[model samples]
Target chain A: MNTQAVKVIYKYEMLRAWNTILQSFASPVISTILYFVVFGSAIGSRIESVEGISYGAFIVPGLIMLALLTQSVSNASFGIYFPRFTGTMYETLSAPISFIEIVLGYVGAAATKSFIIGLIILVTAGFFVELKIAHPIWMLSFLILTCISFSLLGFIIGLWAESFEQLQLIPLLVITPLVFLGGSFYTIDMLPPAWQTVSLFNPVVYLVSGFRWSFYEVSDVSVELSLLMVLLFSVICLSIVWWMFKTGYRLKR
Target chain B: MSSIISVSNLSKVYDGGFRALNDISLDIKSGEILALLGPNGAGKTTLISVICGIVNASAGSVTVDGYDIVKDYRITRSMIGLVPQELTLSMFVSVWDTICFSRGLFGKKPNPLYLEQLLKDLSLWDKKDNDILTLSGGMKRRVLIAKALSHEPSILFLDEPTAGVDVELRKDMWVLVEKLRQTGVTIILTTHYIEEAEEIADRVGVINEGELIVVDDKEALKHKLGKRQMMIELEQTIESIPESLWTWSLELSGNGSRLTYTYDSYSEHTGIAELLRAVDKSGLLLKDVNTSQSSLEDIFIGLVKVNNEGSA
Candidate 1:
């Protein structure tokens, strides 16, 4: 329980976030605004309501979730990956810190950065559509949980990736498609029955559906199932990280 | 002095079945500078890595102050600081922040006064606010030293501390290392430069092909293994060795204008007087006589060559 070590690592990571203000903070905000402009104005004109909620407001939670997933993954993965790339990880590995503290520091900082971006996007969504949270506590919990879980996944990716190409491979080729197909802009109910069944298989659906439920009290899946899924994913990521540190995979050799 | 770090039967084999270390054992005394000299890929880094808890040993164990490096990692790690060979640093972080963070990572409470003095000692105080990316290679190396010392560890490992460094910085680093030695910090440094070991090390350990071939006090090793050469220049050339000097193993060179005699310096009877007397009695006109001692470099090359031949 080296709290000082954790704090030091966490603060250094956060400082790095500030140093790259444009990429860490501004990129997600601008992208979220653009989503609103394009989807709210172009798509909202034709589709007036989604499950009795205004079309513009219906996608807010999904958009925020989308930002949360990608930001958390990218931030955390790059946080760990850059250290490995620069060979500076030796410093941390040789320090008097445990693996848990190292994970806590890096994953904690990445999650915080993603959580802040999600909140900023949520506030910016207010400008385009009237927003309300039917269950604010659940919304906050889901946001925090999603940030943490995704950040852990990102940490694993950072450890597993050997090159920059591999680092971006999953986030772009896997996560972005899942987010888009998981109902970021529209509900799965609008899809054909067969496609709707397949959409349920995508893990992002559970995350977006659970997040959307907090906003409008309507979702593609039960909120309880989504919560269970997120917890399960978090546990899986934690186990892998534990095993990685124990075996010194890609870190020690 | 008691041994602060003890390694017993340590071995490391990489995933591909390449044995990087082979049953290496060593005991380092506290407050002495030990230099581990080896060629590239001689497992110098691997040995250091295992002791520092960065690389896991495949066999046996290492203990720092009697605490196991693996089971008691945190405790032992806190006692050691490593200046790695690679100049790895965060480009965006300021020098001050980097050192502070390194210290904190060791779970040490903030000691700004100590850090300030450390910066001053390394001559990095003026560039404390500047980002690491802006600093030159030499300055970055200095920062690495500052970072290693930030935790105030009793044992410090400097892995090639002066590799690729300029002559001036190398001299300054030697001075700083000596100063640190005076402060009672046990320093273990690995180097390919034999002069570095000869200049500052109290003990010298030679590792070749993943095995520690020799470890002895610097002066003792020099005296025991080093051979001296005596060169005698003659005013006139000779066609062959004089019968009077036949007992002495002397070789005529420079087209017979000079004679060289190799002898064990550590031996009580070098027989230099007898050889010179025999040469004078043989009627050889001596123009000049000089003696040269073998350096650590010569001894190292000889040892490595012999070991290679024996293994081959």
Candidate 2:
């Protein structure tokens, strides 16, 4: 209901993103481009196809999802963490704004930044590999939902992390490995039967698989299951955030 | 005058059983400056935080304009603006955007003219487009004051506002504070400097060991608790005080070369004339005489010492 408050917080965050344009936007675009060169040109020459689609085109959705997940988590986490670190959070906490409004402001801005990066990476991916959206609506929905869910997760991490090491811990040791092992660059079908079963446990698999289905109607898991998993993860993150605010965990003392 | 904020029987115990506040009760009258004076760890900041709704009370309650702080947090919070002790700011943010954002966060409509006036009032208009990192420490403190006032809250809490600033800036801050009072905003400031309280506060509250030991009109507190001392230097050194002068409750120092008489200043007759006449009659030759009154600092130290000894 406090749209003005949300707008102010969101604008301030977005301005910070623009201030660090290279780190926020350019770095991801360039990294995705490099991934195309190394994966599409170097490795694609050895393996021409993944399933029926060309290997170069096959990883496009996964790469975008990878970037989306990382950027959403890091951006949102840093957004909240920096405020706390500098003690400027008192300004927002003492304001007349509600917790929901605060969340909407911070999380909304993080998702928008990640969403933009995801779309840009998708376009950059198109330059190296021929791309198609089998279900454009589903692809956009999946992209947006992934951004929101991951940003919420990042918001929780921002609250829970007590130090800089802990902030980077989940993203580096946990999230990156899950994304790479979740079949971002290769299909789980290429893995042996036992390995594929192990890969199914990784949550990033559901996100990438669901997004890939939107792109080429091919995925490691069924489209319905992927959507359900994303929805469930979103619900869980929301509940945790709601509880944090209600209990004044980290945000208040 | 009606009280704008009331805190009753408030107490706060941190997670580790550290009792930061103990049954504090205070009322802040509208449009008056109330200064809370305490030593380090006396719970001055904690008291301000509770009334501002930044910290939750373990027991009891606080109300702003009769609205409960916890149940009606939004309404009560909207009425208060806090200038915290820390210099916390987003360094990359421009001064203009910072104030504007703070105003919007309070759900206020855009008022560029008012904001312009605020900037001008704080002498920050020239630096409006500059990043906060480029500003000096004093300027940053001014920006904080500006941000707190951006929403035009009726109640302002300034915690150690002049802690590290120079005397010139401290004077300017008080001038600005007086200007704000003219607009009918209630101000509550906390300081360890008794002079700061003496300079600006209409009423002074001395808190020691998490308990408000005294709250009274500044002048009245001094008048009631203050002591006057009269020192007389003897023409010759004497080993001990004469038995006749002992009736005056005198203290002999400087190897009996000086005598000090302590008395209540508020009493109609200080009995100083009698003491002098008695000294003369006792053949105590006086070389020089001087009188001095105890300051707020002395009274504060005395009160804290008493409180510590009582609890010990």
Candidate 3:
């Protein structure tokens, strides 16, 4: 994989990114805790078992995916966007650092932040309701893949964006809505056949299914298909990133 | 000596059809400080951007230290460090950390001694642990310079590096540049301020309306295009110019305290002595005589004005 370059960039950017996250740490942590109390304990009584699992247990994977997706986008977008807005990207581009190094640094940072957030939510979810992992390694794999995929997607969006408004457009107007409609809160099986068929089209569904599969040994879709989707998305994102760097797209030109 | 940077037929026509750099070409000698001077939109920044590979050139080829900028970008880029006009740093990072990170960007291993020396040179060693945002504007500018130098490149490009900096700090920067040049680090700088160029440039290149108007040695550029103005403070107020003084194209001050005469430095006869004799014959008392030579700024304006008139 020749990840030596990626690893160094990842380490430096991750350490610095964690420093940045410290600012929003208290807020997201408190907000997620409040979400558990309000939705898991307060609302769980009204809802019956979802696919034979408790409502609290069913929403846990969805909530973790939700947090992972948003944080990945925001962290990656802001990480690259601020430098571009402030004109520091000029310094970066002029340096000897290859384009691959830059992508690794920024995307790695975003992925790491999301991974940590996913873990925190996982541990937090465990406090409210006991979680039984059918395959812990698969769960971690899916989590890492999901984080890296979204982070790379966010990096592209950041580069393509010119202004602060443009940077926020993808995360707010596009990603948030897609995650919500990706069947995070309820099972697709409960929906009418047509709506469930539509829900399957959302790419986020694969991620949620993969994460949920690790927990209950059950999923809306086959685990192999979900993992394949993740790999496909990763390949597509990497190609786009590689093209942006090679052409010196928005960053250089 | 072999040229370090060879720019041939470089042109940058921005998306708006405004030609920022038009067919500009020059050979920058190894280890020389070449100053690019121009008015706003004269393509100084655009030129440097192309050479540093920061901005794409519409048409042209540049070779840095014999490596093609487009094909051998890694080697070319690694050879040059740029201190941009904008002072942008990772505001959250410490001064020392920022410099080290920049060094690592060039694939250079961390040399603690070199890093310490670079920090000490910029007087940033004292503030090494401080976050970038906490520093003053002058200090931030210094940090930018330090970051650019951290990679130990053979060539350095400074785009208005001293803009908004204090006079003392500006001098400090020049001194550092002088030291760097002595160490065989070729320097290229773009500045709207003429005095900065006059102070350090070995050769001066002027661009106007995206065209390279002239490139010459500092002394030669001044001598070739420079003009001198003779200011004759009159003894008393006068209502009109004397007919005999008309040949000199003299301009009389409204208050009659001064008479101005413009002459080419290259001309054999300035007509100054004859004009003085004419003044005496015309019975005008000359209170005082003072002479001033043209500056690079004057020459630059003169050249641009000539180009504009020719185009018109």
Candidate 4:
């Protein structure tokens, strides 16, 4: 399995995270604080609760999901893309490792980084609101699944991206908007019947809804569907990655 | 010295239909230093890139130590190390970390002692902890070499290893190549510098326009195509070639004071004896006589010119 090769790539990426330790852990933590102050303290006072859960507490899972999604995409994409950009990916491609090892190394490190950020944001959100957990196991499970799935997606984007601008395009124009409109800040129940039906098409609605359910047991969609969504997303991303390596697309040209 | 890497009927056609390699076939003997000499865009880099598994071959097969480059790539690639022409490196990574990381990528256990000695060999031991960005161009070049050798592969492909570095590095690199050769590492290098090949290559291959024009032992190539020249000086200036000397096909040069004869020195009858006799009989008194052999560069230019003219 070339486990040593995987370890090398994983550690190399993790070191980059450690090197930029300030930016890696601090940005999301600070962003989480601002969101709590603005949304939890300032805005939640006007709205007492969301479906029997405090308004501040309701947004906590969504906040973590938002950061997890963005962080996973950006970290994984940059990890692979920067090597390609600098033309150093030759070492990786020329190495004895298989594509699976390459993915395991790069995607695993990125997911680990995002997973840590998700935890930090969760802990930060604790000080702002009285957090409740209906299923702690499920919460951790969902967090890990989301991190892996989104990081896989980011790996695909990294291979697909040709420029730095294209690197940011998917995470910004596609991922961020989906996270926002997928019920990160609010409930789908509040929307009109037609818009609520349309929100089902957004895959992230499944992610946020299922994550929120693990916390408060109040979800717009079933938890099984959310787990299925994460699995499905990961499978699709894996297939694309497989085809990329097989065809030598963008990588071996 | 059996074949370690065998490429047969290989071809590479890019997406836009540009043929980078044209049915190129080569067999690199194990533990020998083979140098590929070619002009720009002459498929030397493309050929190395394909064998290194960085570029996909359109057709044909390459076997490394009896393993297919595609099916058994893990095994084949692990045995091969490529130092690309470009300075492909991460600016932020330390030299020590870079070499170790590259070694690990090949699934090799960490050998700090080996890496330390390697860095010392490349004169990079003192700067091992420094970031690549802070090093000079020559130092970075050394780091690239250290990284490629970190895995301790059996075969090393150095594509234009000394393109821009100073003369001192060039000399050091050749010494290193010679040392590596002694350790039984099969080295294949692509270079524009024909003299570099002539200096170090046990075998030399010339590629032009995606074709392997010629490949032979270094000395044999020079002997095969290299022309020998004889400069004959006369005691008296002559207005023209004497009628008697016309049979020798001598060229009048040095403002008619001298005659030059070009011939294949390897031939049984070089006509040197006959030409001198003709010159003596023609009363063009020879003050001095000298002979010079054409270098590998001259032979390379001659081959490429012929290939180009043939294709045109």
Tell me how each candidate scores on DockQ against the true complex: 0.84, 0.77, 0.43, 0.92
Between candidates 2 and 4, which one is better according to lDDT?
4
Better of 1 and 4 by DockQ: 4
The share of true interface contacts that also appear in candidate 2 amounts to: 0.82
For model 3, the superposed segments whose C-alpha errors exceed 4 Å read A1-12, A20-26, B229-290
Candidate 2 segments exceeding 4 Å error: none
Ten residues in sequence with the least summed lDDT for candidate 3 chain B:
B101-110
lDDT tens readout by residue for model 2, B38-71: 8999999998888776777899899999999888
> Could you report the Cα RMSD, in angstroms, for every candidate shown?
1.3, 1.5, 3.1, 1.1
CAPRI grade, predicted model 1: high
Candidate 4 docking: what grade? high
- Candidate 2: residue A239 lDDT (0-100): 90
True contacts kept of 4: 0.94
For model 1, state the Cα shift of residue B123 in Å. Answer: 1.0
Ordered list by TM-score, greatest first: 4, 1, 2, 3
True contacts kept of each: 0.86, 0.82, 0.52, 0.94
Against the true structure, candidate 1 has what lDDT? 0.94
**Cα lDDT for residue A89, candidate 4:** 95
Chain B TM-score for the candidates in order: 0.97, 0.97, 0.92, 0.97
Candidate 4: regions farther than 4 A off: none
Mind giving the per-residue lDDT tens digits that candidate 3 earns over B97-206?
A: 88877787777777889999888989999999999999999999999888888889999999998989899998998999999999999999998889999999999998
